[model samples]
Target: MSAAAHPREREIAADLRLRAARPPVARLSRKVLLVGTATACVAIAGAVAYAMAARPGAASRPELYAVGGPPPERLAALPADYAAAPKLGPPLPGDLGKPILAAGAPAPTMGAAPSASPEQQRLVQEGEAARTSRLFANEAELRADPSPSNVGGEPVVGQGARAVLDGPVDRRTVSPDRLSAPASPYLLQAGSVIPAALVSGIRSDLPGQVLGQVTQDVFDSVTGRFLLIPQGSKLIGLYDSQIANGQRRVLLAWTRLILPNGKSLVLEKLPAGDAAGYAGLEDQVDRHWGALFGAATLSTILGVGAELGAGYRDSAILRALRLGTSDTFNQVGQQAVGRALSIPPTLTIRPGMPVRVLVAKDLVLEPYSG
Candidate 1:
């Protein structure tokens, strides 16, 4: 300010002051902004973490026996043979429509007198027949080659070791009185006892305690399920639906068992028709129908329309019978069959396939020769 305070000196000092002011403003502003953003980011991150941690039972759901897909490491172990074990049952499906002939038809007026539509009239007459029609569900067994590779086809596993019995089939199970083993021994190991249910009704009909005692060595529990291996001469007899082949009237049926890899094994043949014949629906009940309307005013044939609701169209009358829901079916002749034959449903040899099934309680069979 004293000696060098000339014009040039003053200008230089002024410029120096201005430059210092600019640095502090920019630096300070940046520091404040950066700290604010960092604090906000931390707060947001903490909130997100807390929300995620506070949720309850995020994994809550039915623990399906999933396969081929990996579940959590901590998940409980499934039955070791769960995928390979065969299931002996299957369930059902549906859809619906309304009256084609009547619009305001009251729901309460199903069969009040008789002025019902042709279908309804038929339904009423059949209602009585429904009660009259006798339904018999039974099972029969036959031996088939379990080893497909023996026939020389490359042994490729198409399915898991578990057998599956799904889809509709016409068949019946055998009463215990008839599940006797042959006097001869071949494939059947000695002493396989038949199921007690099998003998319940048959016990009264067979010649002796001999029938139940005949085969005590053929049944083996596979993966916790009772399975019957054919004892050379032992036969499973049943009544079933019709199967058409090329010019041959097949009184029985043999559906393919799909493996995990999709390979198949032809399961044993059950009697002509039965719970056993329908590989998968033994767990199902049957509701039979019959009609009696043939005249100038009506002239309707008896019909058995199984499913009657929306989404239930595809449900089997068999499955519906098992379900026994009002909307599932309308029947007069409903038969409750007893447990007779202990036939193993077809094994699904296919690998990696997961099947969800509902198994109804086993049925109880009493005696009936006619």
Candidate 2:
């Protein structure tokens, strides 16, 4: 209806009309593509949900049945009469409460049956008769009987027979009498030193006597020669002071010194001094106590490690703690006691060590030897 259109404009108008008039196939394809995508997304979501449900996890599934089934009755729950039906009745005619032994059974012996043969039995009986007869016989009658002849045809006195025949069994022969010797200057002179060493370690709480030995030869000052108290003589010392738990000091004085000649000289008085290496010994004991404390600590640590390695349970840990604590406490107590009563430094002489002793008075020589 407008003015006559140009040839170029008519071509352009025809192109626009053709574009507008064409079917909306692209839009339809886009919708179709969107629907396919949505379907695929739904399928993926469903697969994921199924996988989650099938996988084993902490989540609990619903039980098929809600209530539990009835419990089965136990045999113990039956009536007393029913339970007692299987028990056996007494077999004896009278209810004596004793088990009935099978018929034809031999009576049970109190102990093993005698297995001795007739010859052995005869010998045993004869020996028993002889022993009874001898027991009733007087000592004089037993002694009057002649000695039994030996295999060599020589009459030999049996020890038993000789004991009865011998005269009143000399009391001295049975138990030797102790020598009664007075203190003599010839035995041990005063102001004489005897070198000796402890036979064993003596504790402050030790009871009774301590033993020692002479380390070297003891010489007489006036004689200028080795005295009868030679080297290797045994020295028995009686602690002068009482050995109490809290008392650590010790004063050892020789009571008796046995000479090499099998004779012993009893000492009456002995002087106390720091002659032996007792000081050094006391120091060593102190060090030992310290080491013991350290050992206790180390043991406690080891116990803890052992308990952990075994298993880290509440009970195990507690038990280990208790044991360790007890052990530590015991060790501490021992150390405390030891410290309270430290051994005197003057009495700390080791075995084989040289020691000097001063005899306070003259000693007596006794025939007895220890």
lDDT of each: 0.33, 0.59
Q: On residues 220-270, what C-alpha lDDT tens digit does candidate 2 reach at each position?
A: 444444355667888887664343333334666667777777777667536
Worst ten-residue run, lDDT, model 1? 335-344
Question: Hey, what RMSD does candidate 2 come out at?
Answer: 28.4
- TM-score per candidate, in order? 0.14, 0.30
Error of 2 at 294 (Å): 10
Candidate 2 residue pairs that clash: 278-348
Superposed on all Cα atoms, the candidates' RMSDs to the truth, in angstroms, are 34.8, 28.4
The digit string of per-residue lDDT tens for model 1 on 207-245 reads 221111112223332222332332221222222332212
